[model samples]
Target: MPTVDFTLRWPDGRQQRCTSPSTVIHEHFVDGQEMPVPELVARMRVAMHAASERVRARYGFACTGAAEQLEQIEAVAARYGGDAGPVTVVAVGKPAVPEVPRAS
Candidate 1:
C-alpha cells in the first residue's frame, strides 16, 4: 500500500501536516488548490474512509492514521463556524508512483 503525506494551510494561516495510509488522497485533492473548510472536511471524510477500507482490504485492519487525519481536519474546521473559509493545499510529500508498463 502507498502512503501519502499532505500539507494544508488552515484558515489562520497555520500549516498542518497530515498523512493517509493509502493513495486515495490524490483522488480527492491536489497541491495548490483551495477548498472551503466544510468541503475540505467532507473530502477528508470520504478519502479517509476509502483509505481505511484499502488498509483493511490489504492488512485486515483499518488505518489509524486515516482516523487521526480526519480528526485533525475536523478540529481545524471547528475553529471556523458556519461559512468557514477555504484552506490551501500546500504540498504532497509523496505522490502516487506511475506504474511501469510491462513488455508484451
Candidate 2:
C-alpha cells in the first residue's frame, strides 16, 4: 500500500522531512490571494509534528516497518524544513511481478 509524504519549511528558509509518511490535515483554503509565507510554513510544521506524534504514540520505540518509514520521514523534514510545498508521497519497495499460469 502507498503512504503519504510531507515536506515542511521554516521561516528561516530551513526545511525538514516528516519523520513518518502519513496523511495530515495541513491544507488550507485561501481566497484569491497569495498565502502568507510565514503562516503557510507554520501550518506545515504543525501538520508534520501532529502526524509524527500520532505515529509515535501508536507505536512505541520499536523497529517495525512503520518505524523505518518514520526515520525516512524525519530525514525529509530535516532537509526541507517545514515550508516545502505538498510533500510527495512515493511508493516504496520494488514493483510486484505478475504470476504466470501453469498447466496442471
Candidate 3:
C-alpha cells in the first residue's frame, strides 16, 4: 500500500493538503482516461454506484462506497501500511505525451 499527498491550490489563494491511499497519480496521456482517485472523490455518488456494480459483477457482491469509499481506502492503507519512499513525483506542468513524426 502507498499513500500520496495531494496538494490542491484554491482560487482564493488558499491551499489544501489531503493524503490519499494511492500508489501513484498518473495524468492523462491518452484521451478518455479516468483518474480513479479524483473521480472517486469528485463524484463519490456516481463512482460508488458504479463500484457497487463493479463488485457485484466480479464476486457477486453488491457493495458500494456511496459515502464510505474514502474511509475504506484509508482503512485499507492503514491495515497494510506503506513505505515512505519509492514514490515517483511528476511535475504538473510536464507534457503528458511525446510528440510523434509522420512517415514520408
Candidate 4:
C-alpha cells in the first residue's frame, strides 16, 4: 500500500497537494526494492492524469490547467519504508503535455 505525495502548482499561483495509492509502484516493486527516480516520476505522472480525469468526471468541470500544472509536478515523498519511519524523496519535474478537453 505505498503512497505518493505530490504538489501541483497552477498558473494562478495556487498550489494543490495530493496523495494517491501507487498501484504501478506496488505492482512493479512488490519486493520493496527502491524504485529508480525516472520510473517513479513516470508512474506519478500517470497517477496524476488518472486523478485529474476522476475529478473532472465527478465534478463536470474542465481541467484545462491540469496539463500545464503538471509541468510543475514535484514528487514530495514516497512512503515505502515499512515500519522504519523512513521516507524517500524523489524530486523530479515533467514536461507539460498537450492539453485535452476534459469535457466529453
Among all candidates shown, the one with the greatest TM-score: 1
- Cα lDDT tens digits, model 2, 6-90, are 4433334454433333444323221222334444445445654555555666665322444555454445445553344444322
Question: How close to the true structure is residue 2 of candidate 4, measured as C-alpha lDDT?
Answer: 32
When summed lDDT is taken over every stretch of 10 residues in candidate 2, the lowest stretch is 25-34
Q: On a 0 to 100 scale, what is the lDDT of residue 64 in model 3?
A: 35
The reply for model 3, stretches above 4 Å from the true place, is 27-104
Candidate 1 similarity to native, TM-score: 0.84
In model 2, state the lDDT of residue 51: 54
Q: Give every collision pair in model 1.
A: none
Clash counts for the predictions, in order? 0, 20, 0, 0
Please report, in order, the local distance difference test score of every candidate based on alpha carbons.
Answer: 0.86, 0.42, 0.36, 0.42
Using Cα atoms with residue i matched to residue i, what is each candidate's TM-score against the true structure? 0.84, 0.36, 0.30, 0.36
- lDDT at 33, model 3: 30
Model 1: per-residue lDDT, tens digit, 1-104?
87888999987789998888888888888889898888888888999999999999999999898898899789878998656567999986685465899999
List the candidate 2 regions with Cα displacement exceeding 4 Å.
6-20, 26-34, 61-104
Q: Which TM-score value belongs to model 2?
A: 0.36
